[model samples]
Target: MATVQFKGIVKKFGDNLVLNGVDVDIKDHEFVVIVGPSGCGKTTLLRMLAGLEEITDGEILIDNLLVNELHPSKREIAMVFQDYALYPHMTVEENMNFALRLRKMDKAEIASRVAEASNVLQLNKFLKRMPKQLSGGQRQRVAIGRAIVRKPKVFLFDEPLSNLDAKLREEMRVEIAKLYQRLNATIIYVTHDQVEAMTLAGRIVIMNHGIVQQVGSPIEVYRKPCNLFVAGFIGSPTMNFMTGKLALEGEALFFKNEDIKLSIPPYLLSDAKKHDGREVVLGVRPDDVLVERDGEKCSDKVQGVLEVCELLGHRENLYLKVGGMRVLATVEAFFNRSPGSAVTLCFNYKNMHVFDKATESRISE
Candidate 1:
């Protein structure tokens, strides 16, 4: 496994620019996932590294050697695509060994590689099965197996699990995670699925508007997002954001909207001191909000009427109208609250995030 590095990479289409001066270094044997909403240049970045799409300008390095002039095959990298791009006529063994055969490896050598890869992927029972005879997950494994047989220095996966059924997608996700460790190969994965990015990556590169937003471990990004796009994008149910004004109520630093007022935690107060009376975006995660009965008193509470309740088996999600905006919060499903009831909502100020209203960048130091 080798490290992949991109220095000052740039990509353009006609008059429009897709990637701008992007510089990232992927360490050896690291499973780095690049994720973003559709058309945010995640695929473009991966394709550039895979030599599928040429960069308009930049340098790409593999194992500390320049590879910008190298062909995809010469780069010694393998790619697995979303479609499971397997040959319909080739048996599973044939599919996995084809690349080696192209290199003029001996027939017995081919069988040895096919056997080992098949065992790793549990594909022996279906070795003779053609692409049509295998399930979607099996086909995906075959695609990966083909790459595995190459013993490539780097592995690239482009939404490889997107076509599988949900259950199958989950199962394949586990397989990919295990395979990464077993191979100990450097991998760069591209996906729009946050769950996949969060679970599979050693570090995640969150992209937006053709720019890299943040690169950090899943928990780091979840706990301390750098900007509004990342803060809102990384969490499920999304972070509840409301426009508010920062103020000082005596010594207390407060974020105040017409209906929602939350005091900034002491840890965050010093950093927010300069933004007093300025409009700020208040961000809080769904799980951090606690619903209380009408008469409860809490440090930072809001009064809102329940507008909708969704029972998601394990949890309850509520939509409430606070001032002109709606807030979504999750609680244990058995809370037994009916819609249209006036309820007091409590939020952990320490867990709150504050962002600049104009820049959409986090202001909570």
Candidate 2:
């Protein structure tokens, strides 16, 4: 296991800056994930660390050694790419031992490494089978086994599960997590999937347009996003946003839009006071929008016409039109309602988020 560090790393294609002054320190034996949408430079950062791409400015260190100029083989890292990248003519055993052969490792030692990795990956039964004969998930396991045999100081996974089906991806996620625990290896994974990052990473580095938006645990990023981008990007079904302005009424602050009004919770008074009368964006997660039961009384309630109801097992996503803005709520699967039906929802203001309109940053506690 090894620590990885990126010091003011920058990448540029001609005049197009891809990564800008990025700095991060990954601890030894830590499973850190860099995740974002495509073209966000997550892969570029990973490639730079792998020595596959050059750093236009700044340095990369592995285990306290500056490796900006080090060859890929000298970086003591193994990368598992999106494609399985297995040789067609080679069997699983051959594929696993190829790197060891290239390094002129002893035959017995190579066999020992292959046996152990095969056992760990449950690929022993398919050792004699060629890549062409293996299923996608099996082939992926073989690819992982190849990396495991190397016993590199750091493991770099670049969307390794992207090719697998949804079910296979979920299974592979658990398998990879177990692999990390078994080996206690320092791993840096890159993916565009936030779900993968949230589940696998000890710390997630959220990036967008070549800039890091936030870096923290999944719960930290989800519960307290630093800006509007993160709050909108990290959650499923996306968070709902309403444009409004703060208004003062006695000691209470109210958020007012055209025909919608929601009282700001007292806990956020200190933060809301600074932006009094200024336009702001009110954010609430789908789960936080409670579907009011019949005759239930709530102080912060809004009525909307149900537009769509997607019945997902255990939970349903209800799309509604509140005033002129669209809102989504995750409710019990049993809560059935047809389109055009009027529904009342309670806004859990205690869990609500308020963002400054000008800067698109969170202003509420």
Candidate 3:
């Protein structure tokens, strides 16, 4: 286990800058995930740390030792790639012990390490199986087992489960999380899936356009997103945004748009005042938007025509058209509503978010 540090890390492919002065730190034995959209330079960042990609500027330190110029083999790190780059000619056990054999380790020691990794990955019964004979999940576990045999100081996984089916991906996520606890190893994983990032990481590093966005625990980032990009990226169903201008009316502050007017919550009063008369974006998650039922009264209400209803077993997703703006709401499945049905929605302002429209940055609480 080792601590990893990226101090002002930058990467470039010719004239195109892939990573723009990114900085982040991972404590020893911490499971940190770097996540973002495609072409965000997350994979490039991981490759730089693994010594596969060059850092155009800044430094990377592992275990307090600068490894900027170190070879990939000498960095004491193992990478499991997206494609599970396994040798078709090798058996599971042979694959796990390949690195050890390359290092000219004793046969007995190599066998011992292979057995331990096999047991940890539950690949004991599949030791003689070839990569082609194994399922997608099993193949991925074998890839992880190969990394574990070296006992690297840090493990880097680049979307290791992306090739698996949905159910298999979910199962592998649990397996990998358990592996983290069992080995207590420092791991840096890169993924574009927020579900994976939120569920597996002790701390998450959000990146966009080659820049680090936010770094925090799952709950911290979800509850307190630093900007519009994070607020939109971190949650399922995505957060809804409405563009409006802040206006002061008597002693109250309101966010007014063409079709909706919402009063700013008390906690945001001071911050809202700073952006008075300026355009702001109000953010509300689908879970916080309630569909009003018969005999129910809500202070903040808006009307929309339901466009689509998707029943997702436990919950439903309602797509609505509110004054030319599209809104998606996730609600309990029991509250059935047909498409084209006009409905009123009530927003829970306690969990609402406000961002400066011009800068796309969150307004402080």
**TM-scores for every predicted model:** 0.95, 0.96, 0.96
User: Residue-wise lDDT of candidate 3 within 68-165, one digit each (tens)?
Assistant: 99999999999999999999999998888999999999999999999998888889999999999999999999999999999999999999988999
- TM for candidate 1 is 0.95
Candidate 3 structure, TM-score to reference: 0.96
TM-score, predicted candidate 2 vs. hidden true structure: 0.96
Badly placed stretches (over 4 Å) of model 3 are 293-299
Summarize candidate 2's per-residue lDDT along 1-365 as a digit string, tens digits: 89999899999989999999888999999999999999999999999999999899998999999999999998889989899899899999999999999999999999999999999999999999999999999999999999999999999999999999999999999999999999999999999999999999999999998888899999999999888999998989799888889998777888899868888776755755666798899888998888865323333778888998899999999998988899999988878677899999877765678889999888777
Q: List the residue pairs that clash in candidate 1.
A: none
Candidate 1 per-residue C-alpha lDDT over 135-189 given as tens digits, one digit per residue, 9 for 90 to 100: 8999999999999888899999999999999999999999999998899899999
Model with the higher lDDT, candidate 1 or 2:
2
Which stretch of 10 consecutive residues in model 2 shows the poorest summed lDDT? 292-301
Question: The CA-based lDDT of model 2 is what?
Answer: 0.90
The per-prediction CA RMSD against the true structure, in angstroms, equals 2.1, 1.9, 1.8
Kindly give the number of clashing pairs for every candidate.
0, 0, 0
Model 1 ranges with Cα > 4 A deviation = 293-299
